[model samples]
Target: MPDASRITPPVVAPTEAPVNPVSMHIRLDPGMPLAHLESVYHAVNTEKNAQGIYQLTLQDAQVPANRDFELLWVPAPGNAPQAALFNEQWQGDEYALLMLMPPAPAPAGATARRVPREVIYVIDTSGSMHGDSIIQARAALKLALERLTTADRFNVIQFNHQTSALFSRAVAATADNLQRALSYVDRLVADGGTEMLPALQLALGQQPEQGVLRQIIFLTDGSVGNEQALFSLIHQQLGDSRLFTVGIGSAPNSFFMTRAAQFGRGTFTYIGKVAEVGEKMAALFSKLETPRLTDIEIHWPQDQPVEMWPARIPDLYLGEPVLVALKLQQPNLPLTLTGDAAGVPWQQQVTLRGGAARSGVHQLWARRKIADLMDQRAQGVAEPEVRKAVLDVALTHRLVSRYTSLVAVDKTPSRPADQGLENKALPTNLPQGWSATKVFGSLPQTATASEWNLLVGLLLLACGVLFSRWPGVGFGVRVGPVSDGKAHGGNVL
Candidate 1:
């Protein structure tokens, strides 16, 4: 047997400043001798066991986000080319596992041709979106509108407490119409509650023109409480309309934005800084203009029982690959994928091969499963049942989720329960380009006609009550009986 004691841990310098604590684990194929372990960042702790699995924990900092896989594979004598494996368990159960990169772009003029698009821009102008948030949103919308061609149809919908469209229906992206849209977006102000449901309904309700790609680009801080409702609406009305979300704040609600885009079968973009608005929106426009891979399906070996997360595959943007984690009973099984690109059918097949054992793939898969379960809960699954399922998966994988959080407890108690606990809030810096006065000073104009209508309704109701009690008043005409004999002595007004 090869001596596992002879292996040496890699010596690597830290690549980047760590923003959050990260932990990683790697499991090698059974009977595979540990030749070496290498990483770009020094691991705070490294431990190897009899089962050929290695675990590493990084405290406070880890490798840079942009860096590729840390473990560099060194093939042993007569070893085949090895793909990367994050984590695995070798139990008696049968399952399947596979990972694949995005297919290369088809040869020039060989793939499906681009389709004309009908773009709808839905922007949130709620109170929380004041300052830099609204500014970035407006700039992004202008960029998208400028990219539309004359052959395309386009419209703009701005929502706060009420929803209003730039046009009653989508109009040709003429120069005049595009200019009008830019001006309309420029005049939008951040105020009122985030009424996204109505805006989404209006955008999705648009009739799809033949041969035109219907897409909705939504920009918001995602600061709404009714995220589930919006998600359900998107799922129900999605039809052929793809919804992309542009997160537009320093600390936007990422959970809502990411899942919404997933349900809408589109991609999500983040614009944390004003400078990134142009760059991010430009990238998004590229995806919008290109043909996307849709109706993707993966076929695994029939002999292997496979369990995968994100059971519903999302549409692939340009250069975006389909990634999934599977608990397989066997390794090195061949797989096939089929999908549609534009209007043409596309398919690919690959034979799985042994590769270098990487780390974190299992945890990534677990995170995806948890997200899917939560999405199901949002879609009306029983809360207790979904919570239980999520908790079991999270606890088994030791992941952080809505039902599970990583908490550190001290064995020795420093303070008694009777000492009482004091709550302190931490102050956060204002988002870049935001003004404190605008955000906190005076409230913007958010009052809507609904308030006036409510007052009028109350007044009318009171007047009716008074008139009923004092029939002598001439505020309303009263009839003692109906001429058609519908009523004998009933009062009518």
Candidate 2:
């Protein structure tokens, strides 16, 4: 036989060197001449608008104009997984992106339900939750209570360093219970460390009432550090309960609260302003009142090699759809989705063919994959394996994960190693009508809360709830502060 290895042609990279990989860190010297400084400022700040530059006439994302939930296949260019061999692209195994847009919410008058419910209201009273966050939480809790019917059973659990419940067990949402619960909520004060695990345990650890929709509406600024511990607890103890997370504040821990809801098999809602509490909470409560779809199953064409994110599919509520990202050997095939919607067997089908490819599908898929990996890490997967896997995906997709970070470094040192650097701290501008940001997550970092920050929170809510809610691929571009002094760089994320 001929030498097979020699017969095959060798694959070569498109370029011998990286085209654009390095991010530069530049600083100006304080001792620079005035003319040089002025020139530098003008050159950096001036935006030379290209006169009538040719722009792509094509629209970016291939989403329908209507709100109807449609199953879509967003294949990569030529079914590719990466762009270039290096830089601004993911060099990894090839796959395609699929999205299942959620159905629009049920009609306002429709969703009158007879099935019973057990609603658990958990609020964070940690010191960081003081001010607007606490007020928002209290108002949200009160609204949820008013929506509860007598047929529903409910309890209120508040936690800081300590955790307490309004009832030893879930009580009927009667006049008396509602009154007492309101009284209990009114006395809550934000003045302790954020101890969330015990509260989660109290909310999810208990057994469910037979034939009742067990739902937990958790309200918090999400200023907690023990995310892994809390996620594990939610995963283990969450037998049949659904969790809905309400992120309360301008810059709450969207990562923690969003993932917590994912693990608890629920959705995330964000209340940015006190004015938004009424509308957003009412919308959420409307969905809560409706019956949720259960026992969902996706049937792909026979014997196709399938690798999908969200290995376990959760039940869907009203306004929530079945969104999935996966890899397939056969891209052009039929797909079937089956589920139980309020005791009714519901199934939908779509033939995989296309109009146009969606933008950033690979990033969306990689994002879901990273979240899945982090879920494994939180569920006690070996640290090294999870880290390596996450790093591969994160680095390949150019995303920020627990395993990867965006860094800025000044390669050239400004002073001698033995010299100490000192400077006066500049005053940070916070958003109007907000207190200082609360430190959150495994590591501590401070961020200024603004209308834009709340917008970020809304975008991070849930993938199933909205196709646009995928984790952002990168950070915002910020223009550095204008100054005559020498510039120094620090890692922002």
> Per-residue lDDT of 1-493 in model 2, one digit per residue for the tens?
1221221122112223212222222232211111111221011222222441122211222321111111112222221111111001123433544343334444567645467899999999986677788899999999999988888999999998799998999999899889999998899888756678889989987877688889999999776666788888988888988999998876667888889989988888877668879987987887777645667676886677667777777766544444666655554656676776566777766544431343455677789998888888667899899989999988977889886899988889888999998973332223223433332222222222245677777777653356445565444333555356423352333
* Error at 484, model 2, angstroms: 74
lDDT per residue as tens, model 1, 1-493: 0221111111122332333233455544433443445553334456778776666565435443322234432223211112223345434432334443333444666644567889999999987688888999999999999988887999999998799998999999998999999899889999765667899999998768787889999999876767778888887778988889998866576778888989988887877768878877987897778746668787886877777776877776653434667666566666677777666787766554444454555677778888888888657889999999999989977998888899998899778978988864323334344444444433222223456678899999998888778855645455676576444676655
- Per-model TM values vs. the true structure: 0.68, 0.66
Ten contiguous residues with the weakest lDDT in model 2: 79-88
Q: What lDDT score goes with residue 271 in model 1?
A: 78
Model 2 pairs in collision: none
Best by lDDT: 1
